[model samples]
Target: MNKSSGPDKNRMDVKKLVSIGIAFTLFFIAQGNILTVTDGGYSPSPKLCSTLKLVPILSLLCVVILVFVLIKMLKHKYVHFKNRELDSKTGSNGLSSMQKDNERKRPAGAKNKTIGMGTDVIKLFQQMKDDISEENTLTLGYRHLLDLACEHLDFSAGVIFIIDHNGCISLRGYSGIIPNSQENYTLELKGIVSELFERNMPRFIRDINSIPGNCQELFYGFKAAWLLPLMPQGFPVGLLIFFHKDVPKHREEYYPKLDFVNIAACWFYENHRNNRIVACENRKIEMLIKTSLAISSSLSLDDVCRILVSDIGKSFGCSYSYLLLSRGRQKEMYVQQCYSERKTPVFEPEEKIIDIENMTWLKEIIAFETPVLLGSEEIKGYPQKDKDILKISGSAGVLIAPLKHNKRLVGILVLVEQRSAERARMGKEVLDLCTALIAQASAAIENARLYSSLSDKVAQLTTMVNVGKALNSDLTLLSFFERVLDGISRNFKIQNCAILLRDFEKDELYVVSVIGHYQEDALNKRFKIGKEGITGRAAALKKTINVDDVSKDDMFIPSTGNTGSEMAIPVILNGEVVGVLDVESEDKYAFSKREEILLSSLMNQVAVAMEKIKLKQLDKERANKLSLTNTLVKKLSGTLDQSDLLANAV
Candidate 1:
């Protein structure tokens, strides 16, 4: 080949041509021993053979060159072999045991068949990471994932085991028929099972019955189990185990598909562990919100308890929840209002409940001043005759939390589990959440009760002063009625109100005082007892009347705006009905039992005031009658001095 033979070619070409030409020449040159040189005769002058070197020098030089060439060739072979191996292994599953010609030679990290993770799984993992770092509401991130596993793996139940405060990792959810399954399926941190938890990787047991060591406890009922470690930020929080349906033989071909499930389950478990932390933190923030709202929005103990318990359940995913109060060191807790999904309270005690100090369950929770989680076994041992009587009631699990306010335990919060393990599993996270919620709820309950007691005292004093003021507010019929109406209306906004006076001789009810929008009609109408309208019915029957829905009332008149509720009162003077006072509301059922009592008292006052005015009228009429009688007597005597008599009479 024609090549550029300048300075670059000169060094390399000279070395290559000399070595190759001499190597072949040495192969052809074979000679026998000749004459002596420097000893006694003619000498050949000690020069190298063919200007290369002396025989001894040449042999040594050729050996050195050959070693160099061999080392270089070996190095080249090693580099190529290593590159091929690396190429095969970069992203592929296992080392290819196939033919050399069939060996893959793609670049390192190139797409390979064993690559299962794509953009979807990567994005999902990224989202899981974000959820770990931030706040989240749902702690069970793999709830939906478990559903997928159920569909794909053909298994019924699965569970995630986490270390508790006591360093015990217990089984939560399970599937299949197993003997004493509830009792035996548990993970202890210090023992054999927990050693695997520390390892934090995928551990598969193909046949549990044939394991090397004493795995009879864990694998007793289980035939095949796959336990995958859930690494939250690369640290093991727990292990997830899935038991196969019936039994299965571990096949190599099944490993690939099983590997996919393991990868997915691992990611979900990681997300769930992170979410548990995030969920707890979010609940803490929610507790702050509920605490602030419970204090500021209202001091209603009932309303505060409602808000507190709801916030707690939302944060903690507690099973059964309630707020309890002891009320001044009574030792026994009074269950105020339990938060649950019930239309009405399932249990309503007619009398206050008393707590037994000697109760085994209450000993540590109440006296020791520590929260407790009574496991399924403890709950089963609890002797509950009352529950037996209920027939369908059982204490699923008990989370006994003390309620503290102003550094004092005023109450006990009992969270009772309602749903089964299929729906939710109660864990240590739930208990911690309840403790925090109780702390916030107790503060609110204490404050609200104090506020209510104070408010009751102030209201009692105010009513005494206002009733006397009502008696002297006005004198005339309409003016006095307006003052009375104003007092009642101060607390309630009514659409229309009227005063009706019974004209007994004519047997008619006269509309005297009216307020609100339908002033024209209320002023226009007059009725006798037993008339068609609601007001007349009250007068006819002589009873206080309350109508919840005016729409249902057959004689309800459509007034200005919409009328929804109505009320009427009978005014009794001298133990006989003299008039009626009627009130109407646009609000449906605006008047409650308390309002009904107060309004009746106002009507009684109106009767007394009106009766006082009637007596004064009677006294004036009697005096006029006596004056006319005197004039009649003067005329009847028939006296001759009529002018003098008329002057006397005047």
Candidate 2:
């Protein structure tokens, strides 16, 4: 051991010697001091007894000193442990009473607005963790954080100014400014906030004069101002500005609490931002999965289209949606599938035909054919009448993503809705959904093409059967036409029905039948095949027209019982249109898929009946001639009169 350690050793030696001396003296006393005497049996003298008592008292005093030393060692151990945790936990190893008292008494703001700054400081950090857990988006994280600060702190007003990639400070949200007024201050708040953020540090100013003139003069005038870096390294992500009457001026006594709060602030932004990013990634994965499922699970084109549009809209929170497709060889765009939200939905007809240019958004969407997005300004371009309709239908903005697939533009989709900032963020998911719908639409078109070809073969077979029946049965032309017309019209759900057949000898088409809610013009009107009127026109062109709105259709002639919609299908025999089956409806686009097939069926029957009737007339003529010739032969054999035989033939 070193010489310096000797004093401590000597002190230990003295204590050991004192203990031995005290023990020896006690033993000597107990053995009895050499005295005897009176009433008690052989007791030591008072002097010896007093010496023993003194030893025990001194020993007890020494024990007390050892205990004091042990206590000191234990206290030193406790202090060491507390120092580490306090520094890491609070960033401040020691805090003065006044600082702690002030923190407890006041959080962030005035009495009425108790920011519960302490509570909020903790909550904000907690919120950062939750946001990171969701992994939705940094923007969302910023919103929640700003809200928590403004709400918990009793500041008169507050704002979160964010530093963008361009190193510019931009005001994101404000609790005090009217929502409408937010735009005015966005650019104005940029300069100073940006400079402060560039400094990459925290600053608290009680009055404007405390700050350097140019940098914080404007900020200082705001009563109390606090700026905290969103990130630790000084590249600012965001900053909070508080205007509060309750906050005491920042001073040395209050620095520790400030230190803790600032540390928490930076952590809040970083963690929350990271969480949002993760959430965004997860959402993208989910959408990809859903898109794949929709394409595989649905079979029919219409079903797939409906599913694609609706799921995307709901998943993305869009209020209204529908699909538009090109129809016929002319590529006329019309509404194919339509749906809307339960709370708010689009109300346009399922079959809207667009022609010319700029008639409405429907036409504009077709023109662009790309994803055309529209907000209030774009939607306002609609006609005053349409605008009124749009308002009632809860549409102020819209986005139309064309169902473009396979390099062959298939269709367009219209999504109309109203939304808030938060709600709009939710809508990004819907945008992706539009891409999935494009594939489903192409499959649908192919399916439709197959169904059309199959329906044609059925029509041909049906025509042959109907012709045989008409020739075999001797029903009057009017009665036969009525049964055929009614069957076709009723099946197609046509509100009005009329048939015009060609007159071979007259070289004209005349009304062969009419069955409807409205009366016909004397029921005997006739016209050349290529003349005016829908029936005549159909015969002229040998085509079909399924017009949704008769009033809007130039081909339609005015009639009674509100003829809002109409269709004309030509009946052909021997590669020529012999007649036309005309139908009308009080409702626009009344012909669904099932209804259209019914019209074709009725037209098939008419074509067959016409062919059968013509054949029967020839057969009857042949039979009559045969009978005349037989009778003449019998007469001639008996009378030998050639002139009589000829007369008999007639």
Candidate 3:
């Protein structure tokens, strides 16, 4: 049995060995076959075949080594791949953790950046506030504010507009590259500006195309614009506008600064408003002071009027300024003094008279003692002549301020061709100022008139006193008449004056003394009472006669061809017309009221002196008759005897 087991184990070993040998053999055969195929089955010697058989074995060994090397490469590749995957997972986890950390820190970083930006904005505001605080004038303040805003906000252009109470807008200040059309931008409140003013809201326009077509022209060349209303005490006073030439990328960044911008705008508005008020008040005070000084400096009405017109033209920037004095019983206003800017046409003819009787507005102005503003639109209501005058003068508007004194209209102060917007802005203020000025001017004018009248009256009284003294110094009637005529001509500034004496016996009026024109021939010229000229008429009617234009009067007897005006005042004494004093001039209406009173007063003294002379002459004549009769009676007694004379008389 041991021998049989041993044999079986040996058989098993032999079979495993046989399997190995067979596999080896098969591999060699295959390799030989491959070699044969590769070598194209080329035969060689037996010795070469034997050497070639070792080639197959060597080839099999090389293939086995190559396979082993390939397996090792695959294992290395798989290990490398697995390690790479593990590394990828670890890297992904690290990245996630880093991302979470970053997310947590982001809010803090953002907060810090926001605080820094806010600080920068505050610093900018403080800088701007410091910059504009030094300005005192409204115009300068506006300029500074606009300039600073443009510089700080990267704006291309800016403008500030002030709206008056009358809904008129004026360009107050501007900065950078303003359009030429906007240089004199003045208009009534209208359009987008007006709408903004009415609504009192801020408007930010990112797209200019969004603007209305009608107002787009105002924002030409601008890509974005902001219009901020300047409201003080809830009243729209002005607008602050900024223009951007380019669209900003981060517009939100600027949104936070809008509040800062608004604060700056409010600062500008308050400062400008205060400055304007101060300036206006200062101007008013200065004007009042200057006017008062002028009024007090002179008693000459002409000088006062000149100062007033000059001041008005300078202060109000009027094209023409003038004063018109009321004249004649017709209440006509005559141009007294005038001042005009360069090349401005005269509004009214020099010394032209404007009748207030037909001008209801003028009458209202005088009656109410207020100013009347007349624009070209309202000028149609004026008289044709006045309308023509205003048109010729190129007046856009005329402000008429009445000069009233003691409840009477003394004169009018007219300012012509004021700018319409400026007029709307300052009309009431100017009117108030002018009203005060007119009050002072009226008083001055009235005082001057009184002074002139008093001076004339005093001179006339002096002349009459001198004449009376001379007449009472035993002067003859003819000498007295000549002296009276000379005094009338010299004192009354009359060129033609005559004294006509009544001849009661002849029932005629005879010129006793004549001063101007055919003086010698006029002397002692007689006219039938109640049938002849002005002197005769005066005597017949026992009243004074004044003809403004003798050419138009049928009763005027031309003493001279140049006599356009004449006055005949009757001298009455003891209830009867004694004589007439006649005066004439080449100028129509030359006899003023003062002259009439002077002549009347002079005639009164003359009449009294003449009456006394007539009485003295009558007494002398009676004495002469008595003496002649006595002498004749004595001569008759001497020649024949008292008895014979008595018998003849009986």
Best by TM-score: 2
Off by over 4 Å in 3: 1-159, 170-201, 206-223, 232-234, 244-317, 325-331, 336-351, 364-368, 372-385, 388-393, 404-408, 417-428, 435-460, 476-593, 596-650
lDDT of 3 by residue, 268-335 (tens): 56665666667667767887786777656645566777777887777777777777887755366677
CA shift of 483, model 3, Å? 4.7
Error (Å) of candidate 2 at residue 147 is 6.4
Candidate 1: list runs displaced more than 4 Å: 1-184, 187-192, 198-236, 240-264, 314-320, 327-329, 349-360, 368-371, 385-393, 467-650
Structural similarity to truth (TM-score) of each candidate:
0.47, 0.57, 0.54
Residues forming the 10-long window of minimal summed lDDT in candidate 1: 94-103
Q: Give lDDT for model 3.
A: 0.67
The best candidate by lDDT is 3
Q: How close is candidate 1 to the true structure, as a TM-score?
A: 0.47
lDDT of predicted model 1: 0.58
Cα lDDT, model 2, residue 2: 23
Model 2 over residues 1-650: C-alpha lDDT tens digits? 12212235346656786798789767765665534354866655766656677777888987887776566556545644654564466443343332233344443332212122344454454454455335344445455555555565444555566654334455555554344421312233344545555554446656644432233322433667665545544454666665565565533333333444445455555555555456556655665665555555534455656665676566556666766666642255666666677744444453265432334555556556455556554465567655553331334357677655455556666676765432443333344445544455555555554554565456545644554565578766666777666554433345677778778787677776677666557266777766666766777788887777676766576555577777778888878877877777787777654556656665776787767666666777799888878887888888867787777767
Model 2: how far is 342 from its true place, Å?
Answer: 7.2
> What ranking emerges by lDDT with the best candidate at the front?
3, 1, 2
Pairs in clash, predicted candidate 2? 115-152, 115-153, 132-275, 135-275, 135-279, 136-279, 137-276, 467-608
